[model samples]
Target chain A: MFNKDNQLEKFKDAETIIGASIKVKGNFQGQGSIIIEGSLEGSLKTDANLFIGDRAKVTANIESKDAIVNGEVRGNIKSKNYLAIGGTAKIFGDIQYGEISVAKGAIINGQLMMLSEEHKRNDKLKPEEKAVATDK
Target chain B: MHVYIYDDYLNKSKYNKTINRIEIRLTDLGLNGKIIRLGGIKNIKGTIQNEIKLGAKTIVAVGNNQTINKIIGAVIDTDIYSDFQKKTILGIIPVGGDNSIAASFGIKNEEEACNILLARRVEKIDLGIVGQYYFLNQATIQSLGTILEIDDYSLEIIKRGEVSIINLLSDKNQSIKSNPHDGKLDIYIKTKRKDQTYLSAKKLLITNPNNKLLVDGVIEMATPIEVGISKDRVNVIVGKDRMFE
Candidate 1:
């Protein structure tokens, strides 16, 4: 069997592009992995990985399953499992996640919070509540 | 039906051509009978309000993002939000360096956008309310926010006008932390580090544990923030094939 972290395995998933010099102003909701290379002026919600490139300038509240930012973000960010910030990142927002990684030089002038068991349990309750509403 | 054109794009000739082309296409569609030409700012300084008051049905924005912004501002300034919404359908021509909001909504070119507008199926899109302005895109703050204010002169001087977001922060970056404007906002901190590669490279797992920080782009606030989704704020004319997905 091949190693998962190997270079060949890395190519199996190519990052999707939002393109450079582009500007978006809306509610950005999606699934699957996405990489922002341009400017985003809105909110982002996703169930998959989201990567903000160093060249990107994002001004949106982001929610994702996993997120790695190496650019400039001016909003709150949320991830369930992982959130990594590169040295080049200039972020001014809040974040919530289970795991966090910050390189030497990353700039974040917001809040950070790790979800406690109670909070995660509450997060679970939200969907159940939604389900009950939909049932009715 | 009057069409007011605004040309504030970097390329003036291209925008003009798009306008002429649109006029030609409308004429071809036998809409010449309803087409009325007006000066770019003829409706400005209190005239558009009169037309809108008379119940204008369609407002076509023929320039770039700023043109759309100006129209939105005028409508809001005139205290005609509901009136504009009830009687108006906005049509945008993506004429600028980057039309992110337009692109995200699947508005590709001037021709396709015009076709959709003429076809007329109103789709209510969300808008982002930042400060006093209602924007259709995301509002940025902090480092990215500061960069937006960089003057054009500085931009031109720094490598013949080729500047990226990261390049602007290189010289002046510091361990500057911002104080929370309101107690409700989560204050996240990423203490300055010196590593070349990211923490993802080291295979060392780090967890925020506090549930109070906004990491990477994740926000966890104990109290409600001023920011949230605003629904059905702007009316758009989208094609039938366009997918909301």
Candidate 2:
């Protein structure tokens, strides 16, 4: 049982948390983890992990280091590392990830693209990014 | 040298005992200095500027949040007179209501405030600025249908929430500890559902006209005002019990 609020304790050091009451509609770019529980449109790009809560309704193309989705999304998601799709997740766009875990009841309405290991993105990454991706 | 600027409200007799005790403690600690009552002053910023010119090293505000906020605005405003030898240090003694700023600095009461001042643990802190006023803690506004523009992005708060711009975090329950030494401001947005967000930026603009910016929980100014931190820093006297280092 992934209790939404309780799970937040794990990311207590999160750099940003877009609460359920907020509706963002532009390019939100940053350098740390971001948790979204609200309604968002446009694009989200982060150099770290992203956590989408169960109540969230997002319509943005997302890019992150790692990702966990539990709500509804209508845009493409790109996770450089592992992508964990929870049972209650409802996504409507293509996905790109290195490795992924899909739970029962997860409804995805688009193609799933597994990044090729030959790309060797990890080896090409800057030292700082490799460290962050490993830590996650 | 220490120069205490007493707020006008403290003139009431109810605070006599606290004031007397504070004076005795300050004298005993060899920290007693000139006391100027705000009741007799008209232009606060000018008076403070004159004190800095006269080599007043420490300026202590004796009152609640309003007192501290005024002093911060005044003290920080005096930074242009930097030809002086030392940066004037700002201190506070919480004597009345709305003393959150002082409490964040670990100055709970007038007596404890005196001892904290004696410790003289000075910190260089950032100031949140809106219009001509400055705040040492945080600035807040209602997030009901508010639109904010930061850099190239814009945020529209749909549901009722709170938008806070933090320089120095006073809420111990908050997950992120705000470092006042950092030049950026921490923007915390929380909805009624307890979901929250934290963003750090140098400056942001409120695109909505219906919003009012509440600085340090004391002063309220009209909306659509640009909010950011002052380029200059202030030296503050804090205590060990302070919420943030």
Best by DockQ: 2
Q: Candidate 2, A19: how far from true, in Å? A: 1.6
In angstroms, the error of model 1 at A60 is: 27
Return the lDDT, model 1, position A116.
78
Q: Deviation in angstroms for B158 in model 1?
A: 27
Off by over 4 Å in 1: A1-136, B8-16, B31-45, B142-229, B240-243
Q: Once model 1 is optimally superposed onto the true structure by TM-score, how far is the C-alpha of residue A112 displaced, in angstroms?
A: 29
State the weakest 10-residue window (summed lDDT) of model 2 chain A. A1-10
- Cα error, candidate 1, residue A99 (Å): 24
Q: In candidate 1, what are the lDDT values of residues B121-155, reduced to their tens digit? A: 77776554323445554332222211111111000
CA deviation > 4 Å runs, candidate 2: A1-10, A118-124, A127-136, B78-85, B171-176
Q: Model 2: DockQ against the native?
A: 0.63
lDDT of 2 by residue, B184-243 (tens): 898988776456777888889875578788888778888788888864367778988888
